[model samples]
Target: MNPPEPAHTPQPDVVAAMRGDLADWRQWLARVIVLAYAAAAGLSVVAFSKLCDLAQQGFASVLAFNPWTPLVWTSACTAGVVWLTRRFAPAAAGSGIPQVMATLDPAVPAEARRAFVSLRLSVMKAVLTAGSLLGGLASGREGPSVQIAAGVMQHARRWLPPHPGISEHGLLVAGGAAGIAAAFNAPLAGVMFAIEELASRLEQRSSGLIIAAIVLSGLMGVSFFGNATYFGTIEVPTLRYSMWWPALLLVLATGGLGGVFARLLHASITGQGDRLGRWRAAHPVAFAAACGLAAGAIGIASHGASFGSGYGYTRGLLQGHVDVPLLYVTLRVVATWLAVWSGVPGGIFAPCLAIGAGVGHDVAVLCGAQADASALIALGMAAFLAAVTQAPMTSFIIVMEMVGGHAMVLSLMAAALGASLVSRWIARPLYAALAQAIIARGRLAPAVAAPSR
Candidate 1:
């Protein structure tokens, strides 16, 4: 039988070549899966933005018909949303940043992380955030977007190639950064946020994955929202050293306020030492209604300027197209605090920017820079965000991209750094503190219920 063609044995070289080809194919497949995930994340964020817009429009129509409608409508909406969230997805409450942070912690249990980032919680987050906006709550979608996108990424972990290198922590970072990039159409800011706020090292193997995800999602945002700057470009003059004083003033004022806001927010959300926190914990739904009533009153007093995420108001202030009262900043801050403390799902990002913009305007007037308030406003935005997040690099980069204020890059960096330092003196890192609290709560939850059983 001609020795059966040497028993059809393949050479060592041939076998090795075949194995190499298979490895290459697997790598490419993994890449494709990551790309697909990035695209899905972008699409989800765009859809969420559209829902928020529609909700805001409906609320605007209601306000047009009767400015006082939010009094009852907001209270009812808050009560319903609070009840639904507590019943079905208690993890979906607040801005969602802490939940995302908690998931990245290695010490947190897999089960707790899974519970925090379930698809069900993500869906509820999107719907209830829209509900909050529809009721004219001072909430933003940006923070919730991070958690939503992370949830999508976490869910996709089951489909990934079973490789030790592809850790859940890396996926969470990529997903959350992609959310920020897609939400604001700022890709670089997304990368910086991953490094600074999310505490991602961008390990060699996963670095390419993180960047690719950001690019794809950001491109999707550009495709839908166009390549224009988020807040539109301004005609800022060349920065002179003499004009730096206003930035310093804003650093102190905005930073101080931002620190206070972070402290109060953390206390309220965690129910630490504040009396209001105890009340909210005891009767969440009823307390939400009361908070809503207060928000409604603030909105009425501010002539609707304090409603929604305050995006339009901030843009108006930046463009000098709208005029608000001296107490606009105060009202916006209080409104944001109440809306968040009510136990609804929303973000403080846009509301904080609006508050910062108002502060910028006041500073500009004081410093006699009324002729060009855009730069000061941009500085205030960066400063307050940095102070609140304790992430100066990410804050400045995001502000720069949002306003297209490259000319003021140095000033933005300075303001952000200065404000972050000042805020550090007043409060702990807001998201990290909240994240640790989440982990502690998760650890205690079973024990707390075990006694009941």
Candidate 2:
């Protein structure tokens, strides 16, 4: 007792070593978290896809007998679902990319956190998106996949170590990126999307976390879905000198059409608080039913081509098995517009690619270069998506991955850059502008939220 206790001390060398070890451990933990997110998101999206596919089959079954019956049934169901979503889980409404983009902003990360990234909202999104598919809406599930993954990872924060360096924004971006990687099995595209579409500033995201997350999520996808290009493979050889003419024509055609589509969609959603917009906001359920009716009418006219996500039609076009009519592209575009304007929980990625394929087919016929249909279709997909998102890099990379090769990189690049330039004439960017509006709404009305997930 009389002996003075030696003062506790740490050797500088030993302390430095400890700090280094701690940093490494933190990084290791971050990787583990990302992997966990990847596995969960991949498995969940796969299951969701299966269920939605089954629902689409049911819609097809209904359509086989009488289109009118299905039309009325779908409209009623659409109205009911939209009502429920608005009254209860408002967050599960439209393509969720905008919500994720809004919340990831460094300036207002906390504004939409509780509303958009909650576990409860994720569950609602899953259920509602499936319901929308069952209603015969022209919708895709990928957008909901992004929201679910982000929400899951954000909620899993409780399990992470209580380190001072832990960052919520980093986790959100990683989760969203992982979701896209798993959804399309495109890892690099996922990272670019996070940077190009989600975060407004580099400091808001953790690049290390995004890479780790994408690898894990993409691996899970490769394991479950196999390593096939999402749109199936294309055997593109060296382009003939004559192929350039059709390719160039396709670039302008797709770019102009996509730009107009993007501008129209933007105007419909954010119509400067005009009469139509105000009426839509005031009577959302009625308007959603009407939109569903219009989509159903388009599907009837297209002989069922306008139903579901249009994935099967597009894939068939790629494999040279489906001979789609020229009018199908215009009808499908109308269907997509109706469904999107309805604010249903779905994505436009699959539909846009399908429409692009249709456009390519027509352009090929007009240019008498139908022999290279697949290449033209691929180019159109890249071009239209680039114009829509104003993300040429992400669009080109995703298209390349979807096609499973680099043979068309140069061509895809040409289409993407050209389309992006044309799109600038219409608007700044679709996703970025929507994201800004969402952030403003989140702060003004915390209870109001609308997205796919």
RMSD to the true structure for each prediction, in A, is 7.8, 7.3
Shift in Å, residue 318, candidate 1: 1.2
lDDT of 2 by residue, 1-453 (tens): 699989998657988888886767766686576567657766666666677788888787777768676579778768877998888888777888877777766555364575777667877888888888888888888778788778877876776766624478777776777777777888888788777777644443456655676667667778878888877778785699998888888878877888888888877866568886887899999998988888887877777888888888888887778988549888988888888888778878778878888888788778877788888888888888888778898888888998875888888988999988987887768877777777556542455454321
Q: How far is 11's C-alpha from truth in model 1 (Å)?
A: 27
Tell me model 1's lDDT, rounded to 2 decimals: 0.86
lDDT by residue (tens digit), candidate 1, 1-453: 555455676567977888885777656676777778888888888899999999999999989999889899989999999999999888899888888887777666678788888677778899999999999999999999998888877776777776635578887888898889898889898888889888647778878877888778888889999999989987786677868788788899988999998998888888875677778788999999999999999999999999999989889989999888759999999999999889999998888888888999999998998876888999899999899989999889988999999988988899999999999999999998888777666542343221110
Model 2 gets an lDDT of: 0.78
Top TM-score prediction, candidate number: 1
Report the Cα lDDT for residue 324, model 1. 80
Off by over 4 Å in 2: 1-19, 22-27, 109-111, 164-166, 200-206, 442-453
